[model samples]
Target chain A: MDSIEIPKRIETINSFKAQGGKVAAVLPIHYSRALFRAFDILPVEVWGPPEVEASYGGVHLQAYVCSIVHNALSFLKKGGLEIADFILVPHACDSLQGLGSILLDFVKPTQTVAPLYLPRGKRTEDKQFLADEFRALARQLSNLTGKEPGDDKLLECIEREEQADLLLADLYRNRTGLGLDNLSFYRLIRSREYLPAEQFTELAQTALEKHSARNPNGIPILLSGIVPERMEVLKAIEELGGFVVADDFACCGRRLYPKGNERDPFLRMAERIINAPPDPTRGNSIDERAEFLINLAQTYGAKGVIFYELKFCEPELFDLPNLRNSLKQAGLNSVHIEVDIKDPLSNQVITRIGAFLEILE
Target chain B: MDKIVALGIDVGSTTVKMVGVNASGDFEWNYLEGSDPRVEDQVDSFLQRFRTETGMTDSVPLVATGYGRKLVGQAEKIVTEITCHAKGVFKQLGHGGTLIDIGGQDSKVIIIGEEGQVVDFAMNDKCAAGTGRFLENTAGRLRVPLDQMGEVAIAARDEVAISSTCTVFAESEIISLIAHGVKVEPILKGLHRSLIIRVVAMVRSIGLIPPLMLSGGVVKNPAIRKMIEEESGEPVILPEQPQLMGAYGAALIAQKIAVG
Candidate 1:
């Protein structure tokens, strides 16, 4: 099967809704998609539109809100999300939490909005809290779909998602052997964010089987960031003869979970979220996250690291200085570039990346 | 006569600066001019003047830096102001520490390592209040000549606090202060304080390292320099020509490349 285009994905969701399937619009990073799938609901991930003219969202949100939240609110204001049966906002960041309240109180007061509060700490109580939250979310999903998912159905969904996760892991393990450039690799993996679990698995399996042996033949670098929105950054890195051998983006590479065999599906998902990669906002210390990135760089033989920070992201901003110091101590060169989702990569940014590549060379 | 080994151009937001460095990386000659709306024309005119005055050939490697650096088609390489400023200041001061560059459009606090590499940096984001343009806007409102702002601000007996750190809001605040009969000198002093506070916050965010250095066009203001020293609590070291540091750094890079 050909890799699904964005419009095709949207069309598929719309057709599903037309055939009486409910669709839930999800905000970025950390939500249980298996529950949505088991309930026969399509979970469509929203990372804000590529272009945004924020008229209504600005009125509701602060000027300093990150563009992802602003653009998402803009999408709601413009009725772009009318096709979504309900909107699910995860407690991913301050911006998304605030967005959930805004949607609940003002923007879409009558719309069905579910907020999943994923526990941020690692205490014993935190585990119970997350498991309880997932159970609550499952109840909400059950209520929305008017169908309590049986154990068999939930297990089936979990198995499919786990298979997809393994396929993604395999792809990342053999990324260099796949012969796909940075942009193509990200585009392929990110398809899972929107595609149904089974379809995404098929895509990943096909991609893995067709792996080429050609090396990227470029200076390898580890890309660390929140999300890979600016495709131009990856393209520019390739043009500068640098290859992103590994990544720690919240939405893409860091989200994969190892195989878990817990009987209770909700507990399994909760365990997966807690054990996933170290994220700044998700209660991971700077040292832990920095060490994680350093190890990845070392494992991949990456010469340097590129921190693609999203503008106004307080969590990432707070972690950057210490991370840089740690990376340097680990004998790696690193550069940071602040990016906005709405703006394309400027020449100034491209020039900086080029110079960084030259330094690595 | 010193032979020009490489050339550097800084097409900044408010001004265009160019420099030619000798083979030994000493500054040979330089040019500074207000940025024109047509940057390509300005670059061509500047190059023509350089050729006519110094008889330099076009074969010298040219490196560009600044916001408008990409428009300089003649450049063999384009570098960001952050890296270039670090290189230039390290060369000038012969050591690395924290370098604060307040430019026409933006302000940056860059931490340079012992080897003159940019270890880390923080810049004012999508806001011009912490930059030279902040003071320039208020200077125009108060009818104080840009060059005289520093002297006027220093003469203030009692400084008034200008609260807004935004350029547009600060202009309105200035109007209000003038309407309330506040003296221009105190308002100017307050404006300098406001800008310095913002810049210092950035400096602290990156964690200040000494010896603190200052560069960019804004360093010409004695009030800015004094207030920065007073606020940051560090003696400010400056390049001989702070405004040309970006271009000078670019020239240095070009020299290294040519030699290699």
Candidate 2:
């Protein structure tokens, strides 16, 4: 999987664009990739760059906005996304929504923008609302790409995604059994964020076949966070004799698509979103998220949990106290560390993580 | 004079603290000095001074803590100040409770469990407000000594409202208040109150336990301890030599390693 570098993925997208293919930039968290895949639009997920000297993002956005949004705004200001024909900002959180507005009003005023409204509840009305939103988004995409994808195309894309999801589930389920360390596993899985679905599935399948018996060397810990932007956290855990057996990061673990019963493509997409893992931003109760985290920890045989929250992320911060209390009541020791996307890892963070591991030991 | 069984060094933002502990983990000799820019050289000199004063060999187990802990190359183990403070306070107080350590650049409210373990903790985020530096910066502008500022704050009959929690903005606010003929005592009281309120919020965020404990260099200020007590409705427990708790805890950890 390491052989498929990011440069190659960028080149693939650039070459597709060069040949007159439309590119759409999407923010992280839940988004229907089937719509873009069916329309032949290349979807690129925007996780913030590791290091950025903010130009307009800090000046325009609120000082407290998470670095992910800031860096995305910075990327747009610097014309990094000029190649993107349009931008799709999902209704994931307030910051991204605000970023979407800024992009449309000021930065990249000429670029077409779509804001996805994801459903937060399981009611029938919620499902209908999401289905309508998906239809609207499909129309918007069709207008942009000059192709209205049929139900057959949507179903085919869904099947490809379902296959990828199942492969990902299998990979996560046997993660400890796979000899790959934490960083390597995340690097491989996170590639799906940018790489084309079919290409990602091929890589995932190839990696799955090479799985061996469980290594089980260090203490197993569960990681919950907004995103694994701080790849250094994974590296530090591995270096400090800890293995991340499971995770519930928004961009990693919780974003897994659930298999749905509906045969209609739009309805199935809505059901998948409604039935997916509990998300803090989607108004899921802390009890549900906490139970999900605890269950993941228990199933993966994790000794403790690490809550690596992005600093100033209101949704995650609001959910933290209740989540920590719930974990403690369930007799699981957890540590909370605030992360900045710009400086994902620092000596201070390393020391704190080292001490947290010592406590668990 | 007892033979040193372990050594601990805490290279903090404001000051460097080192402690030598006996086999029983009791502080036998200690050193404290303002932190120099060259941390490695400062650490090497401290080690030399310890050896010269106590005639201890270089084989003593050493642990490092605080912000500059990584700079100490001689340390056998490096731990965060959160863990070390909890260990040091719990060992001294002989109970598990909430420990709030307001350092030069940051403040932390840590919840310690029954086993002297850090159950949970929260630190001031990338800001100088509610820290020793906050008062130090404003005190410099007010032409008040750091030690005398607390006493003056305690002597105020009435408090002025300080809206800004930022250290830089608060300095400006203080200047404005002085121009408006606000007494220095009331303004000083307001500053202390503001810092305490910030610290108390952190304590509540971690769910403050009973028997709240205070450490770090800021604890030497009488007004901070008093205001924190008044605001939280809990008497603050102070460790002997509060600023050295991180090093003391590191020394205890070192002693444990040496014994093991």
Candidate 3:
């Protein structure tokens, strides 16, 4: 894809808003679409510039700073962040927290700092805490916009989001028993970035239709790692015929945040997310990550695995050494790729993926 | 003489050091890496170097510390950097001494109370801004040699304050300062002073106290060390080869275990 296509999309969205539609640019990785839609906000994702030049005076952050934050900050400096009236931030990761502070304090004073504190424990206490925090955030928003975030409205939003998630989940299930190859599956995932949720869902539905007509093909492969900052990286993987069967990442290719009950949708959403199967924290029975990967690969009948590592994401980097070891011991064919979202579409990564795919084939 | 040799290996991000204290309570240093690659190999090569240097063929009881401590396979005990730092600092300054260690990747300020218990400590592990890595990166960017950067700072006629909290921006600021007819010496002095200023904030956060022992490779920079003292308005002690403090502490623990 051309580097300008994404900005062009943003431009189109802006022009549409020029004709009197409201445009609210957002970073969709950790935020709930239900919340954004209920606020009557258009959820256009904020991304890094397609091409980046060496900026002489950018603040030197820690080596572990997330590239997404770097790219977003760069885009903000380039006046790309004018589209968002308010930005929602979650403490999903450390870099986000720092960037949120910078944006609010210096870059854009109007940007909201709705600190999303994730639940810590596995109990009703955690649920209650999340529910209360979510309610506080909703109330703060309501006060700002003078729009009551009523229980009925939240539940209605949750139900609508759940429909989209359910359809996507069903689509994943449809491909499970089909013995489809890993490479083609990744392409479908890449298409999600270019196409909206509705369009992406329809394309997935169509692809499954095509798969149903074809004969059984390659082994199931689970693609796991930190969320890709740019879709171009995944497109490279897709072109190589590797299927990204499932992921445990927080970004794209996951369900939109689920909703709670009418009286307490945040609580319900927290519960659903907490109970989501194959959780990154404790999905595999084994404590050792290598054994976990090996067992997961074997149990899932995955012939190959691809780990997409985000540069500056310390937790992922720390986990990687062991994960790679386990994959090697399992005799599973695996490739580990390092990516920074700001410099996502490098020929170096593309060549590496091409070589790895050729070797696997 | 008993062939009891206890070795402390500290594999830090910037440099690695190992010390061997024999059964006689005399400590002999062996195995030091300065900007060396093949760290694991360096460790093994150092072991051989130790054997050759001391002419001792004894089984070395091992304790390892630092970021890569987990990779030191021969360590009988591996301790966290905080504990190792406290032990090392306490030994040097006695009890009730504060500790400031700036490693390549992280900076930590530790306080030891009476009876050598950890009173409180603060760590800035989230960034390399106040760490040795920041200095190293800035030096590279300025095209100034590592050994001369400190001396250059010491020669400053008038110190220019650096306002950037980040190393990347600081590098640009340094370049711009030099470009805008500023003398090189004062800019370097200012850079060192800036690091001290940043580190002092962290020290103040955890409550600074004296007889503070400066530990880590950065302590070698006397100009920076003086700047730290000036910033804190207190004289600070330094360990002999301060970078090896963590590893030495680990070795001390191993010695205790061997003796007991």
Enumerate the candidates' DockQ scores in order.
Answer: 0.32, 0.49, 0.01
Sort by TM-score, top down from the best: 2, 1, 3
Q: Which candidate has the highest TM-score of all?
A: 2
DockQ for candidate 1, C-alpha atoms: 0.32
Which segments of model 1 are wrong by more than 4 Å? A1-7, A18-20, A108-111, A122-129, A217-219, A237-242, A311-325, A332-336, A339-361
Q: Please report how far candidate 1 places residue A82 from its true position, in Å.
A: 1.9
Task: Report lDDT (Cα) of residue A360, candidate 1.
Answer: 75
- In angstroms, the error of model 3 at B19 is 50
Off by over 4 Å in 2: A1-8, A18-20, A49-53, A58-60, A104-108, A212-217
lDDT per residue for candidate 1 within B1-260, as digits (tens), equals: 59988888999999999998988899999999999988889988988988987987757888998888878988998888878888888998899999999999988888888988887777774688988999999999999999999999989888999888679999999999999999899999999999999999989977898999999999999999899999999999998999999999999999998777
Taking the true A–B contacts (Cα pairs closer than 8 Å), what share appears in each candidate?
Answer: 0.31, 0.50, 0.00
Poorest lDDT segment (10 consecutive residues) of candidate 3 chain B:
B22-31
What is candidate 2's TM-score for chain A?
0.95
Task: Predict model 2's lDDT versus the native.
Answer: 0.86
DockQ of 2: 0.49
Q: At residue B34, what lDDT does model 2 achieve?
A: 99
In candidate 1, residue A340 scores what lDDT?
84
Docking class of 2: medium
Q: What TM-score does candidate 2 get on C-alpha atoms?
A: 0.94
Q: On residues B1-260, what C-alpha lDDT tens digit does candidate 2 reach at each position?
A: 88789999999999999998989888899999999989889989999999888887768999999999878988999888888999888888889999999999888888898999988777874789868999999999899999999999998999998999789999999999999998899999999999999999888877888989999999888998999999999998899989999999999999999988
